[model samples]
Target: MTGLGTLDAWVGRTIGVGWLPTRRDLDAYQLRCLNETIGKARVESPFYRSLAGWPETSHLDELKDIDRFPLTTADDLARGDPSLIALPLRDAVRLVTIPTSGTSGRQKRLFFTEADIEATVAYFEHGMATLVRPGSCVAIAFPAERPDSVGDLLMRGLDRMGAIPVALPVDGPVEALVAALRELQPAAIAGMPVTLGAAARCMAADGGPPLRIETALVSADSVSPSFRTALAVIWGTEVFEHWGMTETGYGGALGCDAHDGLHVRETDLHIEIVDADTGRVLPDGSEGEIVITTLRRRGLPLLRYRTGDSGSIAESPCRCGSVLRRLRLAGRIGEPVALGDGKRLRPEVIDDAIFAVTGVIDFLVEFRSGRHMVVGLVTSDPRTVDEVRSVLRSHPAIGPALRAAGIDIAVEIAVDPPPPPCRKRRVLGVEHVA
Candidate 1:
């Protein structure tokens, strides 16, 4: 079993007692926090107070009683209601506005106080300890220049852990990132999966001495198995996956050395899996849309918030022997685009097949009309274009879907397409031919 570097102990200390908190201990603590959060939300937030059928805090006798609360959807947040904020505007230290994908110009705004950000920093400090040693030098590829940015918070966490942090821009040219890695040769790296995968392939193409990096933390996007395999094969580093978003304060769950599944930050947040259609909470091990409720967040307490991400909670204990619950993520909940013959194009499936190609660095996917898929590639070797096409044709999911829809695949090798506006990658939808 792999060591999690005082992580289990820290969780225990935060929740119940020492490092070995039991399920019962966790349930008790969560119930207390839930009641407190509900009471505060009802009294302070106009949105919560305005809800039609909110029950009194006393109704929540146990953690499962959380189902009594109505689910809060992304539309609720995007409504731009100031009433959603439980605290005064002056009390908020940070405000994050995220444009809802697939929605026309709709945005969800989240507010965070200093305490909320500190909670994230604390979580990062402990979770990252699982990957890096005290004196390790880590390269951060996520945005870091701004105050209260995810990378800046990660840097602070590393500082607390006695590790050195190097800021590498995620949006910068791949050549620049490769050069920085060659110069610093940091012991560990952290970034979105695609950006890190590109850097790894670029560095490998240079054909010099191998980087001494031992571990990596990939987040902010759904990590495909092929990306992990490629990173390990190219960089000779163990990849740890992290699951979080801006709404969760950027630190929700982190994988330990065991790598079976990610361990949730139970002390800070309560996670539930609910059926997407019925809004009914599902049992552990049942895959459904992820629902989250903040147990301790103060700035804006989200009660039974429906996060559109699909995932499940592990029924069994972690092999690493941590009392924290394990979360197995299954990417986004719904299909954004539909193909004919009851088939949908999942970008994650395509990502798996495409990144598995050896010379591929990155690619942009476009779903055009007439059931056609266009892939624009940035590859280390020109020959990879043909190989990528072959891989996609032979892929189990992509092949069948395309064949069923009578979709023809087109490949265009490019020098470099413009970086995505955000860190997460998705398949673009185009209505007409150019």
Candidate 2:
């Protein structure tokens, strides 16, 4: 049995070598993982046994003949009792829980054991090794909800690596955060793209402290390239992006130094890109839903869980020497707005349009009906509404698609306002019908 230190050492070595495993190695590892996971599910989880319809199977190869076990939805977890836990309550060493994004109706609860926490820490440490050097000072800009939240995990990892951790909690007024940044003066920063962008704009206008940030890591939401460029200009640093979800224990993939695409943690988990409607696996470089199977979780494990995000896998290895398979997340599958003419438009299209407008701070897109959509934008200047409308009308995707769909675009612009603090904020869509 590998302990936490052993796991950390393995992650460090694997990441140093670019975190890529050969296809043969991947296949063998997957077989072993499938066997262990299937055996555990059949013996411990009555829900899984009923769902899989084969409680007596001794090996996963038998279940592989059936379509990969159906994805475990947030709804399923929320509707079930806590007795669904596969392990004894007394044996669980650690508990890390987070509220879902609530983009869906209700938020689901997630539980992580000590081993699960160790695995998550190992994955993050490995991912950060690609961008962050040891002993670098890291300033985090995220919600400060609990002592054992993701922010705490990041701080602990940085501490273990001998780096200074500066936490700038974003649950308060923007002015207070600006004051803290002036005091900390950390080397690196991490936060949601929207919050970080807003902070950058504030510094640019208020003439605050000189932000000598070397790298800015953005996650917890989809970020547009234009937004990345804007933040880079504000902070005078390169912006890095990461993708993950709560069900995967807040672990997903990381972008390479090239900044072209994200490399999946194939050794830690198996990724399957499947068609959203058909649930059939798609070829590489084709967009579909991202489904993940955890290979290394001991407590509160998930098998073939649907992430509700849309992305494609890159066929070739990155030039950065990482052997892990790369994935390009287009946007969330649930963020698409359905039109009256049976067509759907992704939020990325709208995001790209809004971000193209100069001086735009933060924005939200609301889908009121099949024919009406509103864009609420925060900006420093008052002329932002017209600028936003022009950009939206000029976009090849949003403008032409909306015109063809016979829907009108409405733009609402306002000065910067503080956003409510929450674990997950949906800046893209509010009240999506489809």
What are the per-residue Cα lDDT tens digits for candidate 2 across 135-241? 88888886535655777776766677667878895877666777788788877887877677767766766755568677877775467777777777877767777
Work out the TM-score per prediction: 0.95, 0.85
lDDT of 1 by residue, 198-252 (tens): 8887777767767767899989436888888888888888988899998888998
Candidate models: Cα lDDT each: 0.83, 0.68
Q: RMSD to the native, candidate 1?
A: 2.4
Model 2 alpha-carbon drift over 4 Å, by segment: 1-9, 12-23, 53-68, 81-83, 93-106, 367-373, 403-416, 420-433
Estimate the lDDT of model 1: 0.83
Residue pairs in collision within model 2: 20-323
Which residue window of length 10 is worst by lDDT in model 1? 425-434
Q: Which one is best on TM-score? A: 1
Clashes of each: 0, 1
